[model samples]
Target: MKIYADNAATTKMSPAAVQVMIRCMEEDYGNPSSLYTIGQKAKETLELAREDVAAVINASPREIYFTSGGSEADNQALLTAAQIGKKKGKMHIISSAFEHHAILHTLQRLEKDGFEVTLLDVHEDGLVRPEELEAAIREDTCLVTIMYANNEIGTIQPIAEIGAICRAHQVLFHTDAVQAVGHLPIDVEAENIDMLSASGHKFHGPKGAGFLYVKKGIPVTNLIEGGAQERGKRAGTENVPAIAAMTEALKEAVANLEANTKRQLEIRNRLIEGILEIPHTALNGDAVKRLPGNANFCFEGIEGESLLLLLDDKGISASSGSACTSGSLDPSHVLLAIGRVHDVAHGSLRLSMDAATTDEEVEYLIQSVKEVVEYLRGFSPIWRDLMNGKKEFIL
Candidate 1:
C-alpha cells in the first residue's frame, strides 16, 4: 500500500539511465580534459550528451553549459546577467514573488550588492500577469527572470509572452525551468529566452547534474573559477557519466512527453477532485494551467507537518512545501504570495504525481487524506473554536 506522491521533489531514475551511468563509471573513466585517446573518448561521450540535451529544447549544443545542479545553474544565470547589466549601467531586475528560493534568494543578495529588484505579485491562481512584467520594466532594467513552472504549486507561467516582451525591450530574460524542462516542451529561440536553467534529478535523472542554457552571443561571466572547461563559462572536470545519463533520461522523457503528461494529468485531476470534496479544503494554484502532475491543497485547522507525518505512517510520501524549506516553521512564501492566510497556508499539502502513478494509488491517497484531515481537525483548537462561534479569532 506504499504510495509515493512526491515526484516533484525527485523521481526514481529509470533503469536505462542507471545502466548507462554504471557503464560509464566502470568502463569509461577517462578525464575529458586530457589529450589522450581515452580522454578523447570521454570527450565524445560528453558532447553527444550535450547534443541530446540541446535537441530537447531546440537549442544549439554550444548554448548548453553543464552545472552541478539547478541551484548552481540559477546562480550562474543571475550573477552573469547582473554582471552584464552592471557593464551597461543597468541595475534594475524583475521577477515574480512566487519563484523558487533559488531565484528569490539570489535576487535578494544582488539587491544588497546594489542591484534594485522588483518582485511582482502573483494572482490568486498562482500566476503573474504578463502585463505586470511589461509595466515593471524600466529603461535601466537589466534582466527579467521568471520560472517556467512553480515547484511547490505547479503553476506554469506565461514564459513565451514574457520572453517576447523582454525581446522587444532589449532586456535579457532568464527562466528557472527546473520543474518544467523535461516534463514540458521548451524552445529557447521561439520563446525568446536569453538564458534558462534546469536540473536532471527533477526528471528521473541522477542528482548533482544540470545545465544552464545561455543563448549564443549573449554576454555571460564565469561563476566558477579556473580552467577552460564549458568554453571557460563553467570550469571543472566534466562529469561525463552523470551528464550522459541525464541526457538519456531527458531523451526518454521528451520522447514520451505527450503520453506521460496525459497520464499524469489524469491522476492529478482525479486526486484534486477527490481531495477537494472535504469541507474547508481548497486547491492551491490554477485549476487548469498547472503542471500535469501537481495537486496542492490547503486544509483549514491542520498543520501540514502533522498531516505529512500521519501520511508517512500510512506509507504515503508527500510534502507540505518545497523540500528545500520544509524544515522551516514558516508558512510557504508561495501560499502567502497568492493571498493565503497564515493559518491556512500552514496547512498546505503538495502531492505531486508522475507518469507511473496508478489509479488505485491515487484513490488510496484520496481516502487516506480524507481520514487524516478529519482526524487532525478533531483535535485542532482552531476548528473547535470556529464550531463554537469564535469566527473573529480564526483568521
Candidate 2:
C-alpha cells in the first residue's frame, strides 16, 4: 500500500539527484566566492549547473539566478518588476486571483506601498481567458504576473498567449512556474515571458533550491543586496551542492517529459473517471486542459480534512489544497475563484500524481476514496439531512 498522490506538494528526491548532491558536498566542498583552487572547482560546478538549468528552459545561462526556493524567486520577481515599473511611471500591475500565495502576498505588499493591483477572476475551468487579461491592462499597467499552472486544481493557464499580450502592450510578464517548469516544456523566448520562477523540489530535486529566469535586457533591481553572486542580482554564498543536484533533476525531468506526461495522464484519467462514479460528486477544474498529473474533485457533504485523515489510515496521501495553506481551515481561494460555493469547496480533494505513480496505486486510491467518502457521509449530519429531503447542505 502506502500510495502517495501528493506530488504537487513536494516530491521524493531521485537517487541520481541525491548522489550528485553527495558528490558535490564531499568532493567540491569550497566556497564559490573564494579565489582558491577548491573554490574555483566549486565555481565551475556552479556555472555548469546554471548552464544545465538554463538549457532545460532554452534560456541563456546568464538569464538564470539561483534563489532560496520558489517563494523567494516569486517574491524577487514581483518586487523587482514592480520597482522597474515604478521607475517607468507605471504603478498598476495585473494578476489572477488563483495565483499561489507567494505571488499574491507579494502583490498585496506592493498594493499597500502605492501600487495598483487588478486581480482577475478565472472561469469555472480554473483558467483565465487571454481576452480577459488583455482587457485588464491599462495605460499605467506595467507588469502582468500569471502562473503557468495552478498548484491546487492543476489547471494550466494560457501562458504563451498571455505572454504575447504582455509583449504587445510593452508590459513586463512574469510567471510563477514552480509547478510547471520541469514537468512541462517552457521556452522563455518562445513564450515571450520576461521573467519566470521555479523550484527544485517540485521536480524531484532537493528542497531549498530554485531559480528565477529574467530575460536579458529586462530592467530588474536586485532584491538581495551586498554581493556579486548571481551577477550581483542575488546575494550570499550559493548552495553549490543543492544547485548541482537541482540541475541534474531538472535535466532528467525535461529529458523524460513526453513519456512521463503520457503515463501520468493515463493514471490521472483513471482516477478522475473512477472518482466521478461516486454519487453526489463531481470533478474540479477543466477535464481536458488540466495538468497531466492532477485530479481534483468535490464531494457533496463531507469535510476535506476528515476525508484526508481517513485516507491516511488506509496508507494513502492526498491534499485538500495548497500545502502552504494546509494549516488554515479556510476554503481554497482558487476553488472559490472558480465559482465553488463554501460547502462544495470544503469537501474538495486534490490528488496529484507523478511519473513514479502506478496503475495499482491509482486503483487503490479510487477505491480507498470511495470507502472514505461513504464512511464520512454516514456520520455527516449534512449528508443525512440531504438524504431525508433537506437539500440545503448539499454541495
The models' CA-based lDDT, in order, is 0.93, 0.93
Residue clash pairs of candidate 2: none
Positional deviation of 296 in candidate 2, in angstroms?
A: 0.6
- Per-residue lDDT for 262-355 in model 2, tens only? 9999999999999999999988889988889999999998899999999999999999999999979999999999999998899999999997
Clashes of 2: 0
- Candidate 1 lDDT trough over 10 residues, lowest sum: 386-395
Candidates in order, TM-scores: namely: 0.99, 0.98
Q: Tally clashing residue pairs in candidate 1.
A: 0
Residues 36-64, model 1: lDDT tens digits: 98888899999999998988898999999
In angstroms, the error of model 2 at 156 is: 0.6
| Model 1 ranges with Cα > 4 A deviation | 392-395
User: What's model 1's overall lDDT?
Assistant: 0.93
